[model samples]
Target: MNKYIEIIKNAYTGYWNYLKHELISINHWDNYFYGLLCISLIVWLLEICFPWRKNQSIFRNDFWLDTFYMFFNFFLLNLIVLIALSNTAAQFLNDILSFIGISISSFQLFDVDDLPKVLGLFIFFVVGDFIQWNTHRLLHRIPWLWNFHKVHHSVKEMGFAAHLRYHWMEPVIYKSLLYIPMAIIGGFDAQDVAIVHFFNIAIGHLNHANLGWNYGPLKYIFNNPKMHIWHHAKNLPEHSKYGINYGLTLSLWDYLFNTAHIPYNGRDIELGFEGDENFPKDFIHQELYPLSKK
Candidate 1:
C-alpha cells in the first residue's frame, strides 16, 4: 500500500513539474503540440488537394479512435512511462534487468562524447529504427502479437490520423523493449531525438495518408504512402509474410531484411483484413478484443 501510494505521489509530482516546464523547451513537449497541429493542418490540405481514393470520406471510419490514440500516445502512454520509471528510466531498466539475472549498470564501456555529434546521432537513428522495425515485424509475424496489431490495420480508409491507431499494449511492449538496448548504450542526444520525433510524426502521417505521393525512386529509400498502403493490403502476397513493409522511418531495413513486398499497382488497394467487418469499433472493446480467447 505504501509503495503504491508513493508511486502515485511521485507520478503526480512528476506530471505537475512536467506541465510547468513543458512549454519552455521544445524537447519538453511544446514541439509535440506544434508538430501535431502543423502536420495535421498540412495533411488535411494535401488530403483535400490530392486524394488517392476519391470516393473515401474525409471524416473516415474509426476517426475518433485514431484521435484518441494520438492523445493516448502523446500524453497517456508517456505518463505511463513516467509512472513505470518512478521518475527514473535508467533505474527502471536496471531493475528489470536485475530481476532477470542479467545484472548490468546503465552505462557504456566507452564515452560517446569522443564521437562527433552527427556521427552519434546517426548511430542513434540507425539503432533505434532497427529496433522499431524488428518490433513491428514481430507484431505481424507472431500470432499473439498480431492480435494487438490488427487494430491499426482494421481501417479501410487510411489517412493521416490512422498513423497513431494502435492497441494500448503496443507502446508498453515497444518502449520497454527499446529502453533495454538504449539504456545499455549510456548516451542520449536530446536534439537528435527531437528531430527524429518530428520526422517520424511527419512521415508517419504521410505514409498512412490517402494522398498518393510515391516519391518514385525515393520510395525505396523512405517508407511512402504507396509502399505503406501495400502493407495494409487485404490479401497480402503470402500468409507467411503476413503483410509487406514493416519498416518504420526508413525502408533500408526492410530492403536489407528481404521483407519488402510492393506490388506493381498500389493504387486503390484494398485495406483491412477480410472477414473482420464485425470488428469492434469502440475503443475499450477493441483493446479487450485482442486478448479475448473467444
Candidate 2:
C-alpha cells in the first residue's frame, strides 16, 4: 500500500518538478530515471538544433551509438549493482575507511551531519571523477590497461554515443575500484549516490558532444568537449594529452595535474587511434573485436 501511494505521489509531483527547472523532485523516488530520459532526449535534440560542421559524421554515428550505450550501460549498471557489488557501495566505503583509520559512513556523512545533502553529493561526484581522471589516464598510459582503454579510443568518431564505447572490462574497475573507495569514505545515502550518477551521465555527455559551447570559467575546471576531443585525437602526441579536463564539474585536478587542454582555434579535430582504420565497423565488431584473439 505504501509503495503504491509513493508511486502516485511521485507521478503527480513531476509537473511541479518540471516547472522548477530542477532535474528531479526531492521527494519523488522514480524521478531519477524519468529525469535521465528527459535529459538524454534533450541532448539528442540539441545535437540536431545546433549542428557542428566537422562532426556531421559524428551526428550520424550518435543515433545508433547512443542507443547502444544507453542500453549497454543500463544493463551493466544493474548487473554491477545486483551481482558484482551486491548493492553495497556504502559498505565498500566503510572498509576503505577502516584501512585509512577514518571512521566514516556514507549514510552518516550525508544524513547525520550539518552539511546539506546536496552539497555532500556534489562533492562526492567531483572527488570521484578526480580519481577517475587519473585512473583513466593511467589506463591509457600503461600498456596492460591500455589494452582495455584502447577499445574506447578505437572509435573513429566523436559524438554523444562515442562515450559509451568503453571496453566491457571497464565497469568492473569503475564500480568496484574507482567508485567504491570514495563511497566507503563519504558515507552518502542512496539519493546522494543517485545524484552523483546523474552528474556523471550529464557531464559525460557534455564531454563527448560536438557543440562548441563553453561554460566560461567553468570550462577551465570542467571536462568540456573542447578539451576532451584532444584526448581522442588520432595523433599520439595529441592523444597523450590524456589527463586534462579530469574534473567533471571542475578542472582543478587537470590544472593541478597539468593535463588540461583548451584550444583557441575553435576547430573540431579528427578523432580515434590510427590502428582502428582497419578495425571492424559493425556493432558486434565494435563491441567485441578489440578484445578478441587475432
Candidate 3:
C-alpha cells in the first residue's frame, strides 16, 4: 500500500513539475479579469439562448439579490478557506485526509491547473450535484430530512441569487462530504480543482438563469437553464422531477433514477413552495425559520 501510494504521489508531483517548467505561462491578474469577463459573456449568451423560463429577464428585482448573493458567496468561501489555511496547524487540520491514507498534498489539492482543468471542473460539478440530487430526493422522501432540505425549496423565485439562497447548513452537509472525500481520494491537483470550481460557478449561474437557449439534444444531455427552472417548480408533480439534471454538466443520473422530467411545453410550469407562499428572504430568517416550531 505504501509503495502504491508513493508511486501515486510521485506521479502527481512529476506532473506538476512538468507543467510548471514546460506549460505556457499564465498572467494571474490578466487571466482572472479575462476569465470573469468570459464567464459573464457566456452567462449572457445562455440567458439569451436557453432561458429557464419564458419571460425571464436579468433586470428583474431578483437581479440585485443575486448580485449580492454572488458577492457574499465568494467572499464567505474565500474568507473561510483563508482562515483554514492561515496557520500551519489549521492548514493541516483542513487537510487531515492525507494522514488517513489519502495523499493529495495541501498545495496540490487546491491550485487550479490547466489541460485537465476543464474536465476536472465539470466532473466535480457533476459529482457534487449528484450528491445533492440524491440528498434532495431523500429529503423529500423522508420527512425528517425535509426540515432541512425544504429551506431550498422554500425559495419562491429562480435567479442567480437562488443559487445562494440555500440554507448555510445545506452547504456544510453537501459540500463538506463531497469535497473532503474528493480531496482524500486525490484525482486532480489544486489548480485543477480551482478551474473546475470556476466552471461550476458558471454552470450554477446558467442553471438558475432566466434565459431561453434550448439546444434540443444538448438540453436532453446537459442540464440547461430552463430544465433547472422547472426543478424549482412548486407543483407536486413538477417537484417530483427532483432528480433531473441534478449535476451541472450532466443529467444522466436523473435519467438513471427515473426523475428526469421532459417538458412538453418547453417551459417551467411554475415557482415557489407547494402551499407556503410567504417564504422569508432575510438570511437569519431563512436559517432559523426552517428549524423553528411549526
The most accurate candidate by TM-score is 1
**Off by more than 4 A, model 1:** 1-8, 20-30, 80-93, 96-103, 106-110, 239-241
In candidate 1 the C-alpha lDDT for residue 248 amounts to: 76
lDDT of each: 0.77, 0.61, 0.56
TM-scores, all candidates, are 0.86, 0.73, 0.66
Model 2 CA deviation exceeding 4 Å by range: 1-32, 54-59, 80-114, 238-249
Model 2 scores a TM of: 0.73
Each candidate's clash count = 0, 8, 18
Cα lDDT tens digits, model 2, 226-280, are 6777677666355544434445455667778677666553345666776767766
lDDT by residue for model 3 (1-294), tens: 454455455555554454454325455632433454467567766566655554656565456655554554444532343223223223355557556765445535443244365665665656666766666566566555566666666655566555655555555555544654455435665565556666666766667667654457876666666677656766646455433445455656777766776565536466666555566666566567757735
Tens-digit lDDT track for model 1 on 80-188? 6545553355465566788988765434554445778887777777778889999998898888888898888888788888898888778777876787576566467
- Best first by TM-score, ranked: 1, 2, 3
Q: Model 1: C-alpha RMSD to truth?
A: 3.1
Give me the displacement of residue 280 in model 3, in angstroms: 1.0
- Give residue 33's lDDT in candidate 1 (0 to 100): 61
Score residue 90 of candidate 1 by CA lDDT: 48
